[model samples]
Target chain A: MNKYKRYERLAAIVKIFNDNPNTLINLEYFMNLFGIAKSTASEDIDILKDVIEKFNFGKLITVPGAGGGIKYLSISNIDSYRSFVKEMCEKLKDASRIIPGGFLYTADLIYSPSVVSKIGEILSYPFQEKNIDAVVTVETKGIPIAMMCARALNVPLVIIRKDSRVTEGSFVSINYVSGSQRHIRSMSLSRRSLKKGSKVLLIDDFMKAGGTIRGMMELMEEFDAEVVGAGVMISTQKPEEKLVNNYISIFVLKNMDEEKNIIDIEISDWIMGE
Target chain B: MNKYKRYERLAAIVKIFNDNPNTLINLEYFMNLFGIAKSTASEDIDILKDVIEKFNFGKLITVPGAGGGIKYLSISNIDSYRSFVKEMCEKLKDASRIIPGGFLYTADLIYSPSVVSKIGEILSYPFQEKNIDAVVTVETKGIPIAMMCARALNVPLVIIRKDSRVTEGSFVSINYVSGSQRHIRSMSLSRRSLKKGSKVLLIDDFMKAGGTIRGMMELMEEFDAEVVGAGVMISTQKPEEKLVNNYISIFVLKNMDEEKNIIDIEISDWIMGE
Candidate 1:
């Protein structure tokens, strides 16, 4: 192939790895797809690694020997995380977003593919070192973010539904007292959705009193799966007593004065190195 | 600042555009972020377009004059679509996927990020030219694929829930006869989820009688929205009389012989240029 064609192949390989992050792609697959030799494929990957490093994009790991190939890890640097949180905090500060009962309207932001995918990258970073079999979340608002995290981690997303459906066959449902309202709420997972002894990372959109995450943990226990970690996009400051501990959050909602139409928010101290 | 740094910047630019497909990104933002001159930013986009074209990755459009910048279109070549469909059909043919009701268990495949996202790309390609304001789908199984198409189209995903919740404020519910069993089923969308007079693209996981898509179209009519197009990942061939027409599907399920433990499936003829 000519020099330009080689450049095209390099670009294509980068996209394939990016699309399937954390998944191994054998060198032979690429060589056969592009009609190139093993050495040429290796050279292309080397160029990709150099560019990714200089840009601080992410890590490209090359497993040696048999049963190994190239894998892309979607880990963003601390600066990138800080910038993302800061920008999101600014967007959330809009007075109009404060609906009745002080709940910030964030459906638009969470559904935006670019924003949610970036949030997923930041939230998935700390848990990447752990052996996660699936990324789990409750139904409705958290699906997009959890889906992105699952994509980044190269794992399946298991959604815990508020109500079980006939289409899902048999499901295991559990009820727990919500931390905020102290009301009994139930969450269920399809019996076949998760495997016993598998490790799961729990994710959510907001963490007020950690009621939902706590409920999800209990549900995971019923499946005999280990809760490896939990993360949320935002957590309110007033909820001093959280139902769950050791959860990571990107932003902290300090206060929301509905009467005065003012909201106080900041990027989480975790990203600030505080 | 340097040659290597320029290469890194190019890679980052490509990723940013790829992540936020079909959204206009102003050049000034790039210039300020990279601390580069206007000419340098323009030159970087030129290089990206060249690489993308050689690989047939997608198109990078540059708008001129005021309110102009650059945008990326994530349209993969037809060959990529065929390969994706071919591989997924093989995965679906496993005998174990057949459930008690003869319904194929595809929750795992639909939730797999890499596979779903590729399906999203292929499905979103035809609707990219339309004036689509939102990508809509019914709850649970269709969320992941619909989210991907919404991402590709750079629109918010408005999910129609099977049941209403107080958390969503007000909702508009509708009942329709599901084509497969001719059973009356109801679906609802949050009142605030969609805007009046907006264009929508409908997406789903499976189509047995096209009842669900037709129901969605009726629901969209209530919201004063337009249904520009509909697409599904799989559709059964036995449903000779579909409830709706003019929809795209990636795969066709020819037959499922439960007694003989055999399955017949193929990539849709639409993808084969038939």
Candidate 2:
């Protein structure tokens, strides 16, 4: 085996940790990879802990005992993330983003990988330490944001299909009323997609009255899944009351006047205070 | 400005590159970030190039001259990825994955972040140098994989909805036949999601006769977008002639013996040869 220098080992370690976020890695793995002594590997980790903290990249947690090792938890700096969200708000304020209906054309923003990846990191931040087993979302628009959140939390994404398909095998489905449109729709999840008693975080791209999210919470009940948290990328303000009482949003859609070609949106108060 | 040691800088650089795959990074940004001279930054990049290749992490390209910078492309080692796909095949053959109607239940594997992240890298590797402007996929099952591919390519993802929603604004809709079910269905995409004349890569979770992909190709024509390439995770053996002539699949399903609980599956020869 070829021996690696100190700097080379450090660089490789960072890459490995970043790739496998929230995964517990044994020091012996690195020792074996670089053909280094246990002491040297430990020293490298110590330096990494400092570098990660200093840069506000994330947190490096060390678990004690033979079965435990180290994990890199993604936690972006609040100030910088707030600024990023502010920049997005400015972009969303453009009058050209208004569609014919009362909706804002946000497909471009929500579907961008770089943009949603950061949104995922921010949305998953509050639940990172909650030991979330999975991230769940109803099919159609919310899948991308939910996938990114799942990626950040290092968990499997369980997508609830709007309509059941034969290819999903045996599945549990539920029907709920759409808060905004007041229409009933059914959503289903494959039996194997989620585990019983698993803790899950609910994610969506937008929420008008939180009917879909409430529907998801009910669907999770059939699988004996515990809904640990719920997050949405954007939420409308007019309803004042949502079907679900417990959920947070990144941006609050205060107003959208299609005729005036104006949109009033801002980051949520909870996120700003963070 | 705070000064960083050579080892610290190396570790941080790796994290940055890993976080922003396929994004161009100016050397001056690093110089300003570390309060280091351009020559020092150049030396750091040289060492990174050697380290990246030595470890088979990915490729680092230095774009020479003005208006150019360095970019990190996500390219997994072919041998390692082949083995990884082989491992997946083993798990898929467990007999329990078979659902009724001769369909194999694969949600558990495809929804996995770690698994699909690798799958995304392998699928996008072929078209990384193709200057893909976007990764396009139909909604429901393929979003996660496509999002990861878009992330790997540093491009936006454009999802085609099986049914157009009012919130999508003005969209182009098309009808096509479902290859396996022999049913006609319609898919739509927002006009703003993709730019005209943009080059796009198509991705899907599974393909039977490639009808959906072919329909996507037709839809792309409406937007004047170029379909540079198409890829799927799994393709069936029967109906060897696909609806679309130009597309690739990672795994080929030769036979599925539901009664005997046997699944004959393996990585595609094209990928194995790579």
Candidate 3:
């Protein structure tokens, strides 16, 4: 192939892997798609890997030997992650974001594609190595973040809805107490959404009493699935005793003085440590 | 500074633009980030644009004069899109996907990031040149597709909830009849979800009677926003007169024979024409 054609192939490879992160792409698939020899395919993979590493764009993992191919993992550098968390902290400090019930408004941030995509990349880092079958989240606010993580992990996203619709057919619904409000609420998942004995990662926009995450864990039990990990974008420090213990948070909301319009938020130790 | 460094920069730029399509990235931002001169930045963008065009990846628009920079527009080639739609049609042809109410099971497809992301890209193509401020969808089933469209458009996603939540603060609610079922349903949007006078794009997984999209339009009216366009992953042909016209669909479900366990689907004319 000519030099320009090689460049074009490299660009196409980057896009294909980037679009399907953490999913293995066998050598045969590329060879068939580009009609290239094995050696040329290997060279193309090498060039892509080098570019990813040198730029800290993400990680490109090549598995050698039989049954091995290449996989792209979505991860951002520590500096970028820290700066992103700090910027999020600053955004949450806005007085207008503080609602009547002391809940910080996050719709704007969570719904922004650029913001959630970055957050998803950072949050999916630790779980990338795990054999996760699906990324799960409760319906409503957590969908975008979970979608991003699912994209990063190259897995299906299973959303637990607040109510079961007729269109969903059969679903398993479970009742759990709201961690913060201490009220019983129901969440349901379409029976077809998950498979038995699958490894699942739970992601959410916030963690209060951890009731929601705990509820999700109980719901997963019905499907006979294992909860490998759980992560949230924000968590409250007030709830020193969380319902679910092993979880990661990107930001810790230390305090909010409604009257004084003062809010304190900082990057979580886990992220800062990175 | 070096050939390898240039490749690294090129890869980073492609990823950045891909992650945040249809958004502007100022030349100065890249120059400052790389500590490169204006001429070098221009050359870098030119190379990236050439690769995208040569590979049929997407479009890179360079805006001249002040208050302008470069923007990446997501548009897949027609052949790839037709093949993708055909694959989806094959998948939907499974007899099991046909539920009791003649509704096709789509939770599996819509929740899959790869599927939804590709659908979002194809759906966003026509609206790329339009000035769209946000992508809106009725919550639960449509969130993922809307999220993808919002990502492609580089805009925020606004989800309309079936019921208002306290966490959303205040919201505007509207009632509309289900186009097919002829049942009254209500959907609400958070007061702060979209800015007034914003131009919005609507997206959903399926369009039966077009009632939901019409309801969304009515809901958007409460916010003083305009609906620029609407797109769906699948639309049924039985609905000869749609409640909402001027919408694009990826696939047309021509027929569903339950007894014979067969489904006839074709790529949308809009997609095939491209």
Candidate 4:
């Protein structure tokens, strides 16, 4: 093939891995697509994986064995992504503007590409093979990660609203507990937002008591959708806080103090040392 | 190119379009990447656009002129996607589960991916080019859309909490007056969450009187982060009540009543027909 063809070949391989991160694929498909020998296709896949991994895109894992397939995790090359996230968190911690007992410049967390990549990686573990029809979360903050999972899985995102307005009329609501807020604010969803029997992945920015997630679960059940997995950007390693299984978290915030400017944050145990 | 190579090329072009939606590009990037001239690159891009648009992945808008480039807009592609979202809203509208006035199946709006996709498309418009540092939302539900937008923009999601807890230590808070929710909530964010001079894309699931988003802006000020743009999933077209600027809403629930089984929904004008 000519140079243009080679570029096209490499680009196509990268796209496939990106679209189907961490999903198993066989050599036959590659052979058919590239019209290359099994050996050539394998080499192409290898080259694509190496370059993508070099860029900190922790996607496209090749499996070795019978019935092996490639899995796209949508993660960054581990160290780069983690370091990027860690840097962001540290910056937030240092910025006195983030007052204690106040809204943690959490909004910043949602927009940082590096941070989102890491969080997406943590979330992929559970939803990798399961039939995830949609990703669900409360709006505003959760939209970022939810969207990531949806793209990775090629699904859609469902949002839950906290207030009832004429715009999202005729909905199902649950009066459970709130997690960080710790108040009895009501959460609502339009009656027809989620399809019945479709499996869903739940995601959020942070999890403290898991009350909001539970409320979401209750609301999700009202639509008859199954909760396939759950994930959060950060989760507190506290007690009585089991929200969902097969979930992953990127980091765990440590002892934090607003006045003295003391806070300890580290990668979550679930993600670190993996 | 081989069959696989062809598909991979298509995927790369699609992914590029996905990242730079509604934008234009020159053939140089592809030409250089593929070691081909503009002629071949243009042909491949055109082919890529046609095939993908057939599937409603998004439309590729080709711009002409010296600075012309290609852009992608995620629109209706999959039949199931649209129907699924509409059905989601319908499910929440079901009568078996009803809440008080002014709120129906709010959860459905927040959780539906199809609906959220529309929301992402709208919200992404304002921050498509700027160096967006983060996507911010008050914790809980906002996480979902924040996730979606972050993924689309390849950013991280940061969440501010309503209340500070023992674990999170000190937090800065602002009183956000909510006319729709009808109460002012003390929203808080951690000191370590944001950075100075950072551009933030603020998002929330619902916009009624705009208290929550406004509160977030106030918090952003405390940290000196630039409020680059703000968007909402649903904006109540209440006359003269503007909560967010440069905003977009997926659908408008014009009418909703719990006992009357009356609910009206329509696509938001901000994004549709654009």
TM-score of each: 0.90, 0.98, 0.95, 0.56
Docking class of 4: incorrect
Worst 10 residues of 3 chain A by lDDT: A1-10
DockQ of each: 0.49, 0.83, 0.71, 0.21
- In order of DockQ, best first, we have 2, 3, 1, 4
For model 1, how does the per-residue alpha-carbon lDDT over A1-274 read when each residue is reduced to its tens digit? 5344555666667777777889989999988878888798888789888877766778888889899998988775667567777878899998877767657778778887878888899889988768799999998788989999999899999988887553666789999887888999888887888999899999999989998999999999988999989999999887887889879988889999989999898888878888
State how far residue B147 of model 4 sits from its true place (Å).
2.3
Model 1 spans with C-alpha error above 4 angstroms = A1-9, A26-44, B1-10, B26-47, B62-66, B181-184
lDDT of 3 by residue, A146-249 (tens): 99999989899999987666476788999999988999999898788899999999999999889999999999999999999999999899889999998988
Name the 10 consecutive residues with the lowest summed lDDT in model 4 chain A. A95-104
Clashing pairs in 2: none
Candidate 4 residue-wise lDDT, A40-78, digit = tens: 777777766665554445556677898886666665534
Q: Candidate 2's residue-wise lDDT over A219-252, tens digit each?
A: 9999999999899999999799888888889999
Candidate No. with top lDDT: 2
- What is the number of backbone collisions in each predicted candidate, taken in the order shown? 0, 0, 0, 120
Better of 1 and 4 by DockQ: 1
Question: Residues B82-168, candidate 3, lDDT per residue (tens digit)?
Answer: 778778878987878877668788888999989999888888888988989999988878899999999988899998888767476
Better of 2 and 3 by lDDT: 2
Point out where model 4 deviates above 4 Å: A1-123, A130-274, B1-7, B12-98, B126-133, B166-171, B225-229, B239-246, B272-274
Better of 2 and 3 by TM-score: 2
**Model 1: pairs clashing at backbone N, Cα or C within 3 Å:** none
Instruction: Compose the digit string of candidate 4's lDDT tens values, residues B152-220.
Output: 665556777776442344568888777665786788876656666788889877676677787888899
The parts of candidate 2 lying over 4 Å away from their true place are none
Name the fnat for model 3: 0.74
lDDT (Cα, tens digit) per residue for candidate 2, span B1-274 = 4389988898889999999999999999999889999999999999999998888899889988897889998785566587788899899888898888888888888998899999899889888889999999998788888998999999999889888664667788999999988999999987888889999999999998999999999999998999999999998988988898778888899999988989999888887884
